[model samples]
Target chain A: MNLYVKQTRSISFVPKSILAVLILSFFIQCFWHFTFTNFVAKRHALPEPPKASFIRLASLDDSVSAAKLLMLWLQAFDNQPGVSIPLKELNYDRVIQWMNLILEVDNKIQYPLLAAIRFYAEVQDEEKQRKMIAYVSNKFIEKPNERWATMAHAVYMAKHRVKDVALALDIAKLIRQYAKGDNVPYWAKQMEIFILEDMGELESAKIIIGGLLESGELQDAHQRKFLGQRLEEIEQRQKKGE
Target chain B: MNHNLLLTIAKYSIWEAIRDKFLIFILLGFITLFCISLFIGELAITEGLQMQSAILGSTLRLFSVFTMGLFVITSMVREFNDKGFELILSHPVPRSSYYFGKFCGFSVAALIISFMSFCCLCFYAPVNMSLLWSFSLFCELLIIIALSLLCLFSFNSITISFSVVTAFYILSRSIEAIQLISDSPIVASGSFSYKFINSMLDVIAYIIPDIYKFTQTDWLVYLPDVKTDILIVVSQTLIYVSLISCVALFDLYRKEL
Candidate 1:
């Protein structure tokens, strides 16, 4: 009876051995999460914000769940170990598929459109880049901010990498037509100037800046001063060329 | 609905859920994730609230759905394995009462757990919008649980029931996306094959409720009161759950225990 009592007493509120194992497991998991998992996450950080789909879904109508799934697929695709693969061998067909998936859900989303353009540009696939730019131009014709930002980025890429002034100028003209608002930021106006200067169209740069300054839309004193300096610099350069 | 019988069953189900060590595990996991969100918030520095709301809202929604599904299927399997359902049916209990009871039980259990998690969030980073999302999420989980019970009755095997129910939940979530592919220009203007695919997706779109509308965590960060939207969500859940329960009841009536 005493032995039985002693044996029962040994097992108190909780067993000591089980408590030790639980404590040890907690520390082990903490170490693993802080070290191993953290290291891997840092090595392969997501290029785009992860919950962008959830935000878009909240903001958009219908087809939002489809957008979420496509975002998940994009994240998974980006997380692939493709870094070791030769740059030339990196096929952009998957990128196109992911873009189409996102666009299919909500064509208004600028993130996927921008992502497609950047991915194709990175791989130096001018064909895919042109295709993406054309798609964005046609589909987002009404969304001026989205259209201008995307097309401007495309124009910048074209002038430097592809050396295609025609493509750059075409995008610039679209910007001129649709991106008209008092709210249009100065950076967008600068993009057109940058494209023209890159194409040696200093005359167009002078005219665009003159129009911007005259409109009084560059309301901030700093903006007005910056535009005045740029116009003067362009005039000096144009005269120097003559 | 048979209120008394329903209450009894639901009370029993809540008791079972409370006694479940698995539910405790899930609660612990939720708390851990919330802590991690706070840690991430610290790292973000400036946009800490936005980050915490997004992470906590999404994590809670996903984990709660998973917990509800696992709990329903496991409980059903245990009852079946032990001939517990047979013993209950051997009494004066009507099949509908038993079925409704199980649904009520699971919903209450889910409500309690979700409410507790919401309180935990309040302790860390309180937001009125989080409560709205959590409430809608509870409704969504209730609908999922009802559908799960239907699946459990339809398919005798727990594995098949769990898979089919989970698959159904996933498909419901992605139905909008499936419709998008079908309605794409290529499909709309393409050959007979594409039209046929589009037609099938149209039918599916009609069948599955658009759950994306209810599970939006974006509002948790931006909006103060999406009360009208939450009302619509709860009403939709009631209609869906009722339809699903009716089908489950019909199936259970015909089923040989």
Candidate 2:
């Protein structure tokens, strides 16, 4: 009788035991959760802001070559191991495909569509570049800001790809006229003056450079020294001609 | 007269839920998860926003399905197993009030838990300081809680209720994938058994509320320009909850002690 009573008592304590176990398990789970989370946080250090890459696309000829070269450049851009791959890289092929797809349906836009314009400038196909610029200028006469990208493309086409100093100067002036005040970067203004100097428009270049020096925006010692040296060189060239 | 008795019962039921250790533990767990997510967000140098959004969204969805489902099943089962319903019905409280009171208690507990969890998420996730997201999250939480409670009340066994709810959660999460699977050429080419399985999955996807619809953590994370219509989504959630709760209430009223 005593033995049976003892067994019964032990059996009665089973529910209490189970309850205790559940509570202990819950606490242990909580502890593990926090510990694991903190461990992961400590393991991966925050990454640095990525450096931007500049690619000059003015040397290729055919659309296929342009597409292939763009893809190659994009692969290099997107090869960042820890950081996010650049959008320019990931969307490169997508942009090319979109151009092909759109061209299949309609090719009648007065301005070469966005994709064709980009491809033409990138590959430095002079005829295609001229057509795109003319089309853009005619079609987007009212929306200058929208045409800013194409204007930049024109500058690239004239200077780096086609080597047309006069046309580059013309496009640079247009860029200066459109990108005024807070909309423009100071470096862009400097680039405009450089283009004018390259085109032998020395007087206009000197005025722009003098204005830049007065504005105090070009205050960095290295930039000031470089601009001063370039100005001296241009003045020496003109004096020699005189 | 019986309404007052039901109100008192409901009041006590809510108090009981407040004291539940399980709910408290779940809240703690969720808070920890949110904090961890913030730390993880700091590591993502480039796609930090998108990563944060994905983590927060998936975490909230998982928390809803797991924690809320467990609370509903256990609480409902305990009430039946402990014969607490008999004690309440024996009082001056009407049977209708007793049942309604229990539902209200569970609903309120779920609401409070959801609200607390949402607040924690907002604090941790890099969301823009928009009151709209918080309010929308609250509404979604209520619907999820109500859905869970309905599943619990529909089944006799707590284990079965839990199983059904888990299955529902899985189906809801994978509804798009399931649809794609059904439409795949491989499935089409397979035997009759594969086709039948795919058809069954499609029926489940159609029948169940895709809980994924309520998840807006991604938007909060990404801070996208698009704005979601809150009123329409809330109304849809309310309709689903009301329909389920009504069925559960009718069944509960007819159930014998």
Candidate 3:
């Protein structure tokens, strides 16, 4: 009777030991998660630079000499080397600084601003990339020439770098609105379909491809063939799911 | 005396290899990888040309080595492991005829797979219609398969088949590096281990065919001025493949079945 009692006590002890270990592991995991979330939150909450004070050179009266000086100063501030140097030797921060100056002076110089957006995206700086993209979009709304460049840059940034599906779709819609005659608009639509397919919105992608095929706009043999193949692939995928 | 029967057996061997399930699986896997590559290609917005070339080049290398290695090893090993050779020998088929037939069969299958892969890439990716470079890449894949089969049947062991083929691939890639390292005076004057390593590398380079010679995809995709001499690369590939296949057949015939 006494030995049986002792065996029961040992068996109960095993469960207690396991429970203690589980509790210890749970606490450790929670601690790490708390620390990581706090670190990321604190970093994201930091103040951004004043966007309005940067130079605004939207007019012809802004002297050519003054623009040139501002460009030089921005290069120095951003630490970018002169254009003559090979790209490998160029400083990224200097490129961003010059881009900021261009954005400040003439919001119409979309390429430099796009370069700044690209630099931020490359570094995986999501906050800065987002800020730059938003600023460009606002400028694009006011100016007409920057439309194509803005849409293209946003498509690249959202789809590849940031991987923001909603933003990519919005940019695609914006391209269609702004770019009417050019091939860029069609390419943007294709990119949207691709993004939709990637995101598992098969029905939406099929509808888009079907509409393109039926619209008569894809008159070229090559483009038609490509669309046909893509639609067939999507249909096959859907059938398999069924 | 029975030449017709020998030819029949050889024909059957070729058919069996073409219908191999493992080879089909490898081809399907390669297709999936190619599709994935298009997604990865999007990341090359900054350095478009260089990145595209790298992605395509690496994709070709990966599929060629992996598919060729798997097909060659599995085909050779199964003949021994499954005792399929006994069935062939039970008939009136000459051993040499069987070996040659198997080699030819594998060669055809490898060619078809390589061509299909090239076509798929051409259709899917932004490929230029440069016949010479495309043909050269196909020939290169054939040569790689031929070398792998030669090494595989020579060893007659699946484990050795994989090891030797992988070794050949690495050696082929290292040829230029080996040459550079061998000519370095500092290395020549270094410790025993360093000298020994360099000497070993030199020996490997001499023994292995430089497979990198066949890689012309980058020039085709990137540089407009670069054009491959189609006839030269094709002839070189054929000569190398014939030599390796002949050696492999001789080895197979001499083995005690």
Candidate 4:
């Protein structure tokens, strides 16, 4: 080749090499990401947590913002035209993915968690509803924090969403353990009675009500009268056991 | 190949940007907005500092991209349309040198923006892993700057150039969503029409920058768990920017200007 053509060819080699490397690296990164999400997704070895761009805008540490973003994304599935139609048509797996991210980010946020629980229950996604309750219990209530309010919310979710009265009672008892004040323990006692009654554990529930009444914990006049009536009903049932 | 000439032109471009009123205004606005975000973050239930950092990081990315595109277009227009470029071309400088010099100048401006944003973020949040986000933002801006330059050189009209750059920005940011559409069952395994559309999307996907992979915004929130692959990001950015720069150089060489 002539000197000019040789120089031109030499210069062209640089960009050609660079282009090949770029394409190669791009595919390698893609394959790496694919393997991660498919194989290591369950292993939790994924390098980066993936989320919808809009939802990912919310910071992970900020559960409040995460909750807010989750709510907004869920609102897309509500009863509205143009927007809801597309979102509603989304596969259950897609909705589950969004829910899993939201629950992962902010299991302690009250309104959002409650809303998610209700939505999953309404959609008859029993597994997801149970998973939401389990997440709240595990991440929030089970941890060492003054999470009485959060525990109460979780108990409420268990009762309504999963209809697991026994599980709700266990959570209510766990709340009683973390209760630092008289007020929350009193509420927990009440929740225990209600859940036990719902579970058809009437004998256990009656015993709890009797102990609560005997300890004079139901000092509020209206509440006392209510407990007194409950005691009377239990006593009547016990006597009718012929 | 003339490194000294490229540095000189680049230094001049940086000086021009430093003196530009828009840069000053943006800097001031960034500081004010960061402070406002801190106060707004307090209203959050927990992780107030994380919230503040995220807001600042995202806003910085968006503002930097917009301003870089605007700056590249207007600067190119000022140089070419106003015959300012003739003064530089009168010298023995190559067209590629001039293009690379302008890119270097924009890169400096982008670095300054990233540094300022990171400084503001550090004022309220921890800087352990958050530094990765600013670095990624820098890489992201480098890609934008290169794209802006490429579009500016190819399309002489500022309006067309700006539109193309902005569209690229939006598409790159939405690459994941586009991939989802292509991957959806109806599209992936559907009839010929859907398959054709999916094929077209696949082609477009290959062309667009993957902006989603560049974002490490989660680091601004949960530091311990978020691992940003800086190697991949840096390598991808270098390759993309270099490729785009070569394209701009070739186009400018063919131009009769």
Candidate 5:
């Protein structure tokens, strides 16, 4: 080869060889990466959820994005390498803490509540379900009108997921006690009466349904009529029970 | 490829950057981002200053990369179009020498940005963590500078070169997330497409530098369990930057300019 060609070939050969070695190191790091590289190892490791205050700080006041990002990471956490941990298998304290943090970060979004209902509460373990329900129940106390729906989900978890009417009634009663304002949908307040009927407490259902009919908060004629019908149905059930 | 010639080229390039008001722009940008972070910092429920510094640090890191990338690409392309390369090549200098000289000049610029980030962040985090974060940022910038050089030499279009470099940076930063998701149960297994995709992702992951390991914002909030070692940081930077610079030098040699 001419001198120019020879020089060019030499330069190219060095770079190509360097690239080969660099690539080889990367590949070696992939299979047995912990031997040298923390990148691959860190990728498989689940991060401990940070404190809510710090998360809020890290978000730079963009609570909406912060909440969504946390929710995504939390939901995706159960799927680890080679083996997926069931949602029920997760650390309930951390999961609950994450939900609390996320909710605190952005109260305007229902993302955490949705996770509580759809993902966290849907677990097969009754104890886990109760924990999630209790979390939702307590969180609802802060903003009843906005959070009654999550409590309703908690009520569902109690009634269906945990198969405990008492716990369901407890959560359902919270909707009645705290969700008193008209701005909160009456349907939320009505959950308690429905749960009472489900529990075969016809007298209790009758009293609540009757009280609601007389409370004058039912501005909508349709709601009044629905409660009126519910009262009659409870009375009919009560007579049959006697 | 006289050592003095390479050093001279590097010196003049950095002087030219100062003349272009590049340092002033970076300083002003840093101040502005810090101020914005300050206002947003108060909005945090806790650790207002810590949040401010972390935001500022990460933003400065990104800003440095962008400005450096633009500076290198635009400057090189302008020189190439102006036949400045011919003027320099006529001085008994090899193409590899000129290419590496420019890389050195850009490396200095990267160092400035990383140091600024460290100085601004030291108040919020432990000095060692800030140092690691800043050093990681510097290494990350070095990779970008080298990659930008290769891209500019390869594509020769400002738009195309910047785009490819940008895409590479983004992929490197987020590639870990992609690999992690694939490793998780998110992707359905027992299918050819899944396995094939995973195999491809694995290879790509291995080929690229692990950028997600660098300049992490979490380092500001909580002390990481596995502290990123400075040894790995330096090694990865050296390997990737050297290999990329070599490739750029090789490419430069083939160009007629």
Candidate 6:
């Protein structure tokens, strides 16, 4: 009888200890979750994008889908961890890294390059805007034929957003210089002339228009006519200034 | 080889998948995941439908793989457990026919799933791209099926076979990326450990199928070189499937059923 009682006591002791620990664990879990739920900082914590290697590995050989998914996540980041984080307060360098990492997964996808010009460039920070513009410009030079539109947008962002006409002109010229294929429409290079004109470099613009007209690269008669009129207009403006 | 007998066994395998309600599970799981994909698409700031198609395409691709693997592993394991496998061998059927028939049956089932996924996604993605994606997915499935048979015949346990097959799929899929990581100059370079790791990855990559080349989600978005991609998938599928099937055959012949 004593032996049976001792065994029962031993078994009961385990349950009692385990039950106590289990109940204690429930409280611990609740406390941690509550703290986490309440204490997340969104503004200071634009997420560090996952490593490129990790992205490629986790993608299961479907790098394109992985790239798109990361793009979507970055887009929705205005609302991260259930809070609305203003883009200006976020670290732009980290944002650039995320874009680069997404491209590393699948370079064929244009989403990241597009996002640099269209999405992240909206930040109120001038430096962030410039950084985004530079990101797009660099990406454009890498595959100028593929990313001409992005470069055009970057030119616009630099000229208007960054208020840096010189940088815009540089990027605008890169579109024509790097793109050798006919896939880049003729109009993409016209931005350079416009930016040069905007910068009050009429001689440069005339030289460009003359070179283009003589090169017979302008297939469309309308484009050729526009350049002719533009050259005369630049000459007239130069004469009046003189 | 008795063509009729081979076909009969193949038909039996199909019937087994049907009896297990494989199609029904596929349909229900696809619908649920697809709806979730749509929900995610709605959240896209732009390209809502493109997002939807990409998400659905990728998710369904993976779902098909998981279900197909589970079906192959569980169904074969059931045959082993029930002694049905031995029952077939009790007759005068060539063991190669048995293996080939089972392989053909699973492959057909995989094709059906691929078709279903294609049809559902056609309205969303470009037709050419969707077709290529489906074909490549089918080829990918063929490799997995062959690997599954090899794993089952070797391990003969559902748990181990499933685990091993899953690991192989993962490693093969990511092996290219793993190789890149090991060879990356960003880390401390020229170290003995780094060189060893790189060499090991290179050897492993040579053995495994470069699954990174298969079932590219980019194919859905971009206009792929259809002829070239098809050629790649076909050649790789043929080589890998043949090799894996050979290994499975060797393993099966050695067993005293």
Per-prediction DockQ comes to 0.06, 0.04, 0.02, 0.04, 0.02, 0.29
> C-alpha displacement of B67 in model 3, angstroms?
1.9
* lDDT scores of the candidates, listed in order: 0.70, 0.57, 0.59, 0.68, 0.76, 0.83
Tell me the interface RMSD of model 1, in angstroms: 9.3
- For model 1, the stretches where C-alpha displacement exceeds 4 angstroms are A1-83, A92-98, A106-108, A116-143, A151-174, A181-184, A194-202, A213-242, B1-11, B28-63, B77-101, B112-132, B150-164, B167-213, B216-231, B244-257
Worst 10 residues of 5 chain B by lDDT: B42-51
Q: Give fnat of each prediction, in order.
A: 0.00, 0.00, 0.00, 0.02, 0.00, 0.62
Q: Tell me which of candidates 1 and 2 scores higher on DockQ.
A: 1
Model 1, residue B107: displacement in angstroms?
1.5
The per-residue C-alpha lDDT of model 2 at residue B115 equals 65
- At residue A168, give the lDDT of candidate 3: 78
Winner on lDDT between 2 and 4 is 4
Docking class of 3: incorrect
* Residue range B1-257, candidate 3, lDDT tens digits: 35665556556555665555545675677677667556555543343333344455556655666676767677767776888878777777776677656656666666666666566656433555334445566676677667776777677777887787776666565466446535655424777877787788778766666565555444434444434455556666777778887887787677776
Candidate 6 clash pair list: none
The regions of model 6 sitting more than 4 angstroms off are A1-44, A47-51, A159-170, A176-180, A195-204, A232-242, B45-54, B184-200
Lowest summed-lDDT stretch of 10 residues in model 3 chain B? B44-53
Instruction: Report the C-alpha lDDT of model 5 over A126-170, residue by residue, as the tens digit.
Output: 788877787777778888887787787788778886889999899
Cα distance off (Å), candidate 4, residue A47: 35
How well is each residue in A17-47 modelled by candidate 4, as lDDT tens digits?
7889989999999998888755322211112
- Model 2 clashing residue pairs (backbone): A57-A122
Q: What tens-digit string does per-residue lDDT give for candidate 4 at B143-219?
A: 98898888988888889999998878877776666666457554236588877887888898797767766655555
Number of the predicted model whose DockQ against the real structure is largest: 6
DockQ class, candidate 5: incorrect
Error of 3 at B119 (Å): 1.8
Question: How well is each residue in B131-173 modelled by candidate 1, as lDDT tens digits?
Answer: 7767888888888899889888888787898888777777776
Ranking by TM-score: 6, 1, 4, 5, 2, 3
Candidate that beats the other on DockQ, 4 or 6, i.e. the better one: 6
After best superposition, candidate 6 residue A78: deviation in angstroms?
A: 2.8
Question: Candidate 1 lDDT, tens digit per residue, A188-211?
Answer: 656777778877899998898898
TM-score for candidate 3 = 0.49
Itemize residue pairs with steric clashes in candidate 3: A55-A104, A57-A105, A78-A94, A79-A94, A80-A94
